[model samples]
Target: MTKPVGMEVAVAAAEAVALCNIDVAACYPITPNTHIAEHLADIIADGRIDAEYITVESEHSALSAVMGASGTGARTFTATSSQGLMYMHEILPITPAMRLPVVMGLGNRAVSGPINIWNDHSDIIMQRDSGWLSIFADNGQEAVDMFIQAFKIAEHPDVLLPINVNMDGFQLTHVVEPIVFPTQAQVNKFLPPYKPFASLHPDHPLSMGTLGLPEIYTEAVKARDVATVNAKKVIVQIWQEWEKQFGRKYEPVMTYKTAGAEILILTMGSMGETAEVAVDALRKKGVKVGLLKLKLWRPFPFDEIRKAVRGAKTLVVTDRALSYGGPGGPVCSEIRAALYDQPNRPEIVNYIIGLGGRDVRVEDFMKMIEGAPKAKKSGDAYQIYGVRE
Candidate 1:
C-alpha cells in the first residue's frame, strides 16, 4: 500500500491520469476545472508522464481534439466544468456513438445565465442522456480511484463508451486532503494499458458519427443505448478488480446505517458525506434515518437501487440540480421510475438543494427526513429545500 500524502483533489486526479499512462490530453482552461488540465500539462512537461499535451482555445476544441486523438487509438483525457461542458455538448454524444473510449474529469458546477462558479451537478445532469457513463466521487480517494477505474471500464472491449468522472466543483476540487497516491506498480496492476476497440487509420479507414437516415437512425440510437446499459457489467468487473488491488470497494448504490431505518435520505456526490453526519445524529436520537448514495449515474443501476432501498417506509432524495418545471430533481425522478413497479416501494420525497454553490448542512438533511412524510401526505411532488419565502 502506498503511503498517504496531502494533495489537492484536482492534482490527485491529474496524478491518476498520469498513472494510467495516457497518450494524449487535450485541455482548455475553465473555472474550477483548470487546475486539472494545468497539472496534467505540468506532468507531461516535467516528464512525469509521456503524453502529448494539446492546449486548445476553448472547451469545445479541447474535447474535439481529445476525441480525434482517441479516434486515432490514443488513450486520451480532458477536463471541463459548467459552461465548458455545455460548449462541448455537440460532440459529447458523438464520442459514445463512435464508441470512442475517452475519459473526462468533470468539475461538476452549475451552468449559468447569470454566471456563477460554484459546485452543483447541473452541468453533468444536462449531459445525462448523451450516452456517456457518469460516476460521482464523494471525496479525494474516490475521485482518484474512480478515474483510474474509468479508463479500464471505458476501454473494455464490451463497453468502448466514454465516461465522465465528476467531482463537485470547489467542494471537493479545491480541498487539500490526505490521499493515498498508489505507486506506478500498483496502478499498472490495477489498470492495464488502454486497448482501443477501433482506431481511425488511413490504411484501414472507417466511417464514424455518420449521418443516419430516418430508417436507420432509430436503430443506431438503440445500438448505443444497449451498449451503454450493458456497460454496467464492465463497470462492476473493474470496480471488483480495483477492490482486489487496493482493498477499496465501490458500488453503484452504496448505503450507510440502513439496517432497520424507516426513513432514508438518498443523495449523490459529496453531499453523501455531509448527510452521514445527520444520519449519525438522527440515529442517536432513536430516529431510524439512514443514508443512501448513488455513485454511478449512467445506465441507472435499477436493480441495485431497488435492492438498496428495500423495506424503507419513506425515501427522501436530495438533488443538487433542478429540472425546472419538471416533477423534481434528476435523481429523484430516476429513482421513482426505477421503483415504479415494486410492490412495496417507499414513499419517495424529492428535494432540490445546493444549486449554484448553496450550502446544505447536516441539520438540513435531518429536517428533510422529518418533513418527508408530511410532504408525501400533502400530495406535493417535491419541495425546493432552503428556498426563501
Candidate 2:
C-alpha cells in the first residue's frame, strides 16, 4: 500500500492515468476539466508517462482522434466538460457501438443557458443514454479508485465499452484532498496491458466502421444495447476484486443509515456526500430519513436501486439536472419508471437543485425532504428547490 498524499482531485486523476500507461490522450480545454488534461500533458511532456498527448482544435476532434487511436488497439483517454462534452456528443454513442474501451474523465458541469461554468450533473446526465458505462466519485480518493477500475471494466473481454468517471466540476476537480496513491506494481497487477479484441491493421484487412444499413441496423443497435446491459456483471466482478485487493468497497447504489427509516433521499455524483450529512442531522432529530447515493449511471442499476429503497414509504430524488418541460428531472424520470410497476413502491418525488454551481447545504436538503409530501399533494410531480422569494 502506498502512503496517502494531499493533492487536487484533477492532479490525482492525471497520476492514475499515468499509472495505467495509456497509449494516447486526445484533449481540449474546458472549464474544470482542463486541469486534468493539463496535468496529463505535463506528465507526458516530462517523459514520466510514455503516451501521445494530442491537443485538438475541438472536443469533437478530441474524441474523433481517440476513436481512431483506440481502433488501432490503444488504451486511449480524453477529458472535457459542459460544452466540450456536448461538442463531443456526436461521437459518444459511436464508441460503445464500436465496442472501443476508451476511458474518459467528465468534469461535471452545468449546461449553458445564460452561460455558466460550475459543478452540476447536467452535462453528463444529458448524455445518459450514450451507451457508455458511467460512475460518480464522491471524493478525491473515490476519484482515484474509480479511474483505475474504469480502465479495467472498459477493457474487460465481456465488456468492450467506453467508460466515463464523472466528478463534480470545480467541487471535486479543482479541490485538493488527501488521496491514497496506488503503487505502480499494484496498478500493474490490477490493470493489465491492453490486448484488444480486434485491431485495425493491413494484414488483418478488417473493415472498421462499416455503414450500418437499415436491413441490419436494428439488430446492430440491439446488440450494442445488450452488450451494455450485460456489462453490469463484469462491473460487479471487477469492483469486488478491487475491494478484496484495496479494502475499499464500491456498489452501484450505496446506502447510508436506511435501517428503520420511513423517508429516503436519493442522489448522484458528489452531492450524495452532502445529502448523507443531512440524513445524519435529521436522524439525530428523529426525522427517520436516510440517503441513497447512486454511483452507476448507465445500465441504470435498476435492481440495486429497487433494493435500496424497498421499505421506505416516501422517496425524494434530488436531481442536479432539469428536464425542462418534461415530467421531472432526468434521474427522477428514471426512478419513476423503475418503480412504476412495483405494487408497494414508495410515493416518489423529485426536487431539482444545485443547477449551474448552486450550493446544496444540509438545511436545504432537509427542507426538500420535509416539503416533498406537501408538494406531491399539490399534484406537482417535481419541484425546483431554492428559488428566491
Which ranges in model 2 have alpha carbons more than 4 Å from their true place?
none
TM-score quality measure for candidate 2: 0.98
lDDT (CA) per prediction: 0.91, 0.91
Model 2 score (lDDT):
0.91
lDDT of 1 by residue, 1-389 (tens): 87899999999999989999999999887889989988999999999887899988988898899999998899999999999999999999889989999999999999996689998999999999899999999999999999999999999999999999999998999999889988889888888877777788999988766888999989998888999999998899888888888898899998999999998899899999999999999999999988899999997999999999999999999999888889789999999999999999998888899989999998888888888888888787778889998
Local error of candidate 1 at 14, Å? 0.7
Worst 10 residues of 1 by lDDT: 190-199
lDDT per residue for candidate 2 within 1-389, as digits (tens), equals: 87889899998999999999999999998999989999999999999978899989999999999999999999999999999999999999999989999999989999888699998888998888888899999999999999999999999999999999999999899999999988999999999998999999998979778898999999999898888999988998999999999999999988899998899999998888888888988888999999999888887888888888899999999899888799998888988888888888999888889989999998888898888789779888888889786
lDDT of 2 at 357: 94
Clashes of each: 0, 0
